[model samples]
Target: MTSKNLLTALLPLVSDLSRELPERERYRRLLEAMRALLPCDAAALLRLDGEWLVPLAVDGLSDDTLGRRFKVSEHPRFEVLLRSPEPTRFASDSALPDPYDGLIEGFHHHLEVHDCLGCPLFIDERPWGLLTLDALDPLRFDSIELDALQAFASLAAATVNVADRIERLALRAEDEHQRAEVYRQASGQQSKELIGQSKPHKRLVEEINLVGGSDLTVLITGQTGVGKELVAQAIHAASPRAHKPMISLNCAALPDALVESELFGHVRGAFTGALSDRRGKFELADGGTLFLDEVGELSLTVQAKLLRVLQSGQLQRLGSDQEHQVDVRLIAATNRDLAEEVRSGRYRADFYHRLSVYPLQVPPLRERGKDVLLLSGYFLEQNRSHMGLGSLRLSADAQAALLAYDWPGNVRELEHLIGRSALKALGQHRERPRILTLSAADLDLPSPSTAQENPASQLQTASSVAVAVGDLRQATDRYQRQIIEACLTRHQQNWAGAARELGLDRANLSRLARRLGLK
Candidate 1:
């Protein structure tokens, strides 16, 4: 059978071995497969054994080194590789330091393992093991050969990962059961509606509806409360990665010192206050979505690192150069027009082009047409139960108020306004349904006079401020969510009381509250 033949042949063999392939048997078969693929004189599968890698399988090696355990700290090439995302070639071997300058000088010629390629096996960016192959000749493998080896290593890593996970799960059946339950619940919760009948809403949904199923770098554009995160989630849950956790991180939330550590993780003592090791969001979201909300807020320094991860599904932790591979469906969202930001020098052109691979736009609540009323009625019904209030009907006057009001906060804002309105309509301190009592003032949306009166005051805080240059858009959302949430808490869940206190609506207050982690 062809070398390409072994991979296909292994499918059925692996299926039959499903019950449990003894560890020795598994490694032996894997070594056979690798040998068939590369026709190498010597190949070794080094299994991680605590601090050292013990040779579990080797086709060619002197008896001493074949079964000999090599301390990880003593191997200069492997140690350098642990910190780098790129494969270390014999060509690049000389560039590395001389820690092992004479250790392997004669052995390299004796085994004809002079030409070597080492591909690390990673489980969530942590080195689990490695598959190394060597030839008696120097500079034998070219780019194509190396690519095939890399691809083979990836497949091997995946198989090992699944096998390990399965074995561990059997031992921790209870935890696995709980995780399965989470998956089950997640599967059933229908995605929230886009909440609009307007042309913009229709188009936006069409776009999400069209591309949600693929693994693509999606860029969501919209104003705050426009539901960008929801859109991003919709894409993730709709994609193949839905079964995994949809992890999220705010890029603009961190500073230059911490951003790298947060995304790629940090080694113990990598920096000050780094007492122990930590995993970053990318590793945490392996095989799932990594939603970097407000990605445009990233500093140029971080942007460059991010681009590398996008280019190569690999990353190294902060303070360590050892590269580990990660798998994720990246979905980035931001209210800012990234093109404009890129043009104005706030974002990198290369990063912008990469992130814009599938740019998706979410319409502002004001642009979603009749969705305002549709969503308004929905929020009123859902939150009314909490208001100790019975189903509240939106009067004709209330509908008009909702339509005319400029939803600066978008869907989130609308939810809060509706929820608050219902809370206030209820009797002051009860948790049972009260009669839905409400008026135009309950919506809390300003009339033409209110907008005219407050134009200058609101603008002052939003503009001409000493904000972080690149992450300004993120700063805006943080400030916005903070203000909206403060309004909700003051009334003690009494939407009406809060709205009246903030001079806004009971319903809108409830919807906008998720920004504060209230959900």
Candidate 2:
């Protein structure tokens, strides 16, 4: 890389700083220019997020590599690069493991990276992240000039700084420092973010931003496993009270007797199990957001009490006359249709109206298009870290199968399927391979043709059983019991998996099973 070549690469990025390109595109161009100027097999740009380095763009790495979060402490090579001020190069035979081994694009066989070089990017004299290059051939970067690499790193910093300014301007309502603090707090709590690029996902995000700054109660609705809870968290994270705690409760997880006690708390000896005074979820989230999952599961009596608290901001604990006032932003989620429940008199109409002040509907996985692949990448990386695999990827056929499936169980089912498939694929090998690939067969999803026919076949079978039973209530119970038993057997008695497959909350399923005498 000569001075003239370096100027050519640097000039485009400098020009890009004023062009108003998308953030990802800007980073992509940066990596492209770097790989072209430096002549490396693979190159990546990662942003520093606390202790983890998250990839922003890649030039020659596998698609799944973008979803991976590299912890600074776990990757010695990344740690060394971040610690150094100047460009650093590692020996071809360095003892430290290469984070990109078996992850280079277009390589089916396991290939270890032989040469590596990296430069730490800084902005305003503060470490931002790192720019790294890897090559399969030994001594590939030996002839590279450190001066050229350092110049590129400076340009990269300027690029990211511009992008950050644009984003801050977009979020002009919130102070940059305060937003950073909120993100830091959120990361410490290990909260999962909503990740998708589809139009529906983008629209949902727009709604969240539009209403998040307000104090309106949000009612999130969608099918089971569609990530309504995640939507609730995102809304809270975007709110004015982000620095405060965001407490969560599953309304369907507890019985009716304990539901009221759990919401407003209890005094000593309030009930048989109430031996000591305890604070409820409302008190715990007084100054912040309170997330109620499965809110539709609350009984009519509990709904009335909850409605009173929301209306007055005052709640009285069980068996206590003392009233406590709280300022809490309520965010509730449910898969059931609350409007229908209101019409049927199963839910309080006033409460339903209050919760839907700002409604957000999460899209199911099947409707999210290519987002399934992106989510698969996210889950695959998680499994890779947990199982200690060098690299895990999906084959082309596997990607097609994922896109073709109906995803009746939605995101949660996809998550479980990925983990289960990875484990099954691993077990098939006599010894652990450096790079594990999950093929279509490994996924074991029904073919598109078969998937289309399954619903009709199932309905026909149910009809036969209903006719045989000869009574509406008895037929319904028998059908439900049979389906539950089959699902349980298929999952080998894993209640959580069975619940996901049946599109029911685990607690609700358990209660139903007990009612049906299957427990």
Candidate 3:
């Protein structure tokens, strides 16, 4: 290409960097321009994320390639790109496997590339990532202008820095708004003191006291609706950063596509329907605490990015390249067995280890015993206040029902039940009663003694039932799954405990659970 034509092609990219386009779009156009200058069949821009190269933009790779995280230790070609200061090319028959093998457009399952060229990108003399170009023609880049490619790479780096700065400015305002909202939420939750005098409750409080003073990451594990979020609030209230806001996000509540953007913020137009740049929970919780509920539900891709932020306290927004330092004490909660998830390759082991630095298992309601009455009273009062009644109390039969029935749904269920029963009891009276009283009939609990029996009531019933000859295998599998799942729940999803109870190896049980889809 002539110098005049090269300048004309480069002018468009230069003008785009200054335009109000999304960081992702800017990178996409930049990658396209680099390909135009070098004339390659494929081109991609990857950002350095610790030991991994995360694809930011690609012009000729599979759609899944954008979501794939490449570890440098696993891909030698990526390491070569990082080590070299200038542009580097590889031999057509090089033994090193290509990272984009079979992913390059129009290259139908091709494992070997005819020609490959890569230029490392740097900002302020620090290695950022690399820009790569690939072609099927053996001599496609044999005589390309190395200096011109280097100049374009420099321009790309400058564009990334500028976009990053612009995004930071937009995120600042959003972060302040989030901080205020969290403060309001924390204020409302301040009076919700943990209510229980049981041994398990006492032990939990002691554990919280010991761990709260430190800056370690916390993983609160329990069944769904078991007040795991309450425990998180207690920890944050006792921590040094308690004065600052405590931001919370439910990983399971969001779709896989938005999890990363919600946790790490995103620039305007980063993806479809992103009309404006928004700050993520991590940035909003800077200098405070971040509580991630149902964290095990996060996809492996988002888990990898989360691990990076926890380890380094630095994060780049979804579309921006600028890394911002945040000081956040993370508190994560999940009902699922993350260890089992890791064993089954559903969750990353490294991220699991990082999050479980201080593990706290919240006791289920069945184990809390008499604490049920105390919580019943609390919820009764809450309903009374909302209904503008003078007071509310439970009848003797209702108290027995509350204690006898095992709360599979935990605290949340208890709260809802009380509210529902109060309305039902009140509606039964023609005139306003002096003090609304909820009875066993009003509570209407299911088999008050079922769940508290052996944790295997359902499984035992299944095993006793007769099955046809051909359906025996299916029935037996269901029985086994029930037994294993019951044991896991009885042991708080502890593999070692479950293994001991079931007389099976821990690894073997994990493998079985995976096969049974229990994980």
Candidate 4:
């Protein structure tokens, strides 16, 4: 690359520093400029969050690449680049396994031998992240001028610094720093983040940011397995009370008798099972946020009690006359249509009104377009790490199957499918392969036509069994047994997948299976 061409690429980034651009766009243009100057097959800009290198933007890599988190310890090339002061280019035959193996866009094969070049971006003498370039040819950067690349690295650092400054100015400096620290801690613990680039996901994020700083009661409504709980975590993480506890309670997981006690605590003698005085989710989350999953499952009586606390900011423990004052920000999520429940007199209208003060509707997975590929990548990486595999990826046909099928069970279903597919695919090989590629056959998702036919086929089977069973109760039990058996067989006896397929909670499905003598 000529110095003149390098200057041309750097100039655009330098000018972009002053232009107000979205953080993702700025980094995207930076990678675009890098590729233009160096003429590499792929380039990525990653931010160092604790021990993980998170892709902020990418060019010439798969869309799912953005969702992956690369640990510096696992990738030797990344470790060397971060430790070095200047740009480092690995030799073509370098023994270090390429992290980008099977990840380059339009490349279906593992990158056995390829050129890799990277430079660490530093801000205020502290390493911020990395700028990396890769090429299919071995000597792509051998004749390239190192000084030009070094100069461009400095420009990249400036671009990142500008983006950080703009964001800090938008939010409180201390709060933003705290949030970043929380994210770093979460990264170190391998916490799953809400990862996506679709417009719907972006909109949901925007809404989270908009309402997160306040103490608004946010009601998140979505289909089951659509990640409503993750959304609640994100809101709490972004809130002013992030340093405090964010307690969670799943209303549906508990019985009606226990829901009230869980929400408002219970004295030692409150009920037969109440052995000791304990704090409730509200008191436990004092000065923080309280997330109620499946809030719609709460009975009308409990809903009225919950509304009183929301209105008065005080709660009385079960069997206790004294009321306890507590401050808590409420964030509730439900897959049910609470408004319909209220109309049906099953849910309290006033409590429903209070909870919907800020309603956020999480979009289902099918509407997210190609985001399935990105999510698949995230799950694949997780399974790869768990299985101690070099790399795990989806083939073109697997990607097509993921996109074609309607994600009736949403993100949870996708996550389970990917993990199952990876394990099944691995078992097919006598020896472990360096790159485990999941084909459409391994995924085992029904074709669009087959999926359409399944419901009708199931109904037909149910009708045939109804004639053999004498009573309505007997017929219902027989139908349920058949459906559960079919789902279990389809998912290879994976209870989680079977539960998701039947649109029932795993625990509930297990209980039903046991009752039906199928367990």
> Which ranking of candidates, highest TM-score first?
4, 2, 3, 1
Candidates sorted by lDDT, best first: 4, 2, 3, 1
Stretches of model 2 off by over 4 angstroms after superposition: 173-188, 447-519
Off by over 4 Å in 1: 1-193, 427-433, 446-519
What is the C-alpha local distance difference test score of candidate 1? Answer: 0.65
Alpha-carbon RMSD to native, per candidate = 29.7, 11.7, 28.7, 11.9
Task: Report lDDT (CA) for all predictions.
Answer: 0.65, 0.85, 0.79, 0.85
Query: Model 2, range 153-182, lDDT digits (tens) per residue?
Result: 999999999988887788653363475368
Can you tell me which runs of candidate 3 are displaced by over 4 Å?
Answer: 1-190, 446-519
For candidate 3, give the lDDT: 0.79
Ten-residue region with minimum lDDT total, candidate 1: 97-106
lDDT of 1 by residue, 1-519 (tens): 345665674564456346577555676677777776676556777766455665655555432233234556656666765555545566634543321211231332122124666777877878878787666556565533566666667667776776667656654433433444454467665334344444566677667756866687888887788888888876665566667988889887888788898899999999899999899999999988899998878999899999999999999999888998999888898878888888899899999999989988776665454667667655654564344332354544566677666677878888788777766656444554323534577766654322222547656655543264447666666656655555445323545534443455656666655554554
Better of 1 and 2 by lDDT: 2
lDDT of 3 by residue, 1-519 (tens): 678867977899889877898777888889888877888888999888566676778897644356455657767888988999998889998877676655565444334547888989998899989899988887898778888888888898988877767765854423433444455466664234577766678889888867877899999999988899989988886676767988999988999998898899999988998889899999999999999999988988888889899989999988898898999999999999999999999999999999999999998887776778767756765576577554466655676688777688988899899999999899998987545667799999753544334547765666565344347667777777877877677667767656755667879999988988898
Whole-model alpha-carbon lDDT for candidate 2 = 0.85
lDDT tens digits by residue: candidate 4, 278-367: 989999999888999999888888888999999999999999998999999999999999999989989888999999999999988876
> Candidates' TM-scores?
0.50, 0.82, 0.52, 0.83
**Residue 463 lDDT, candidate 4, scale 0-100:** 74
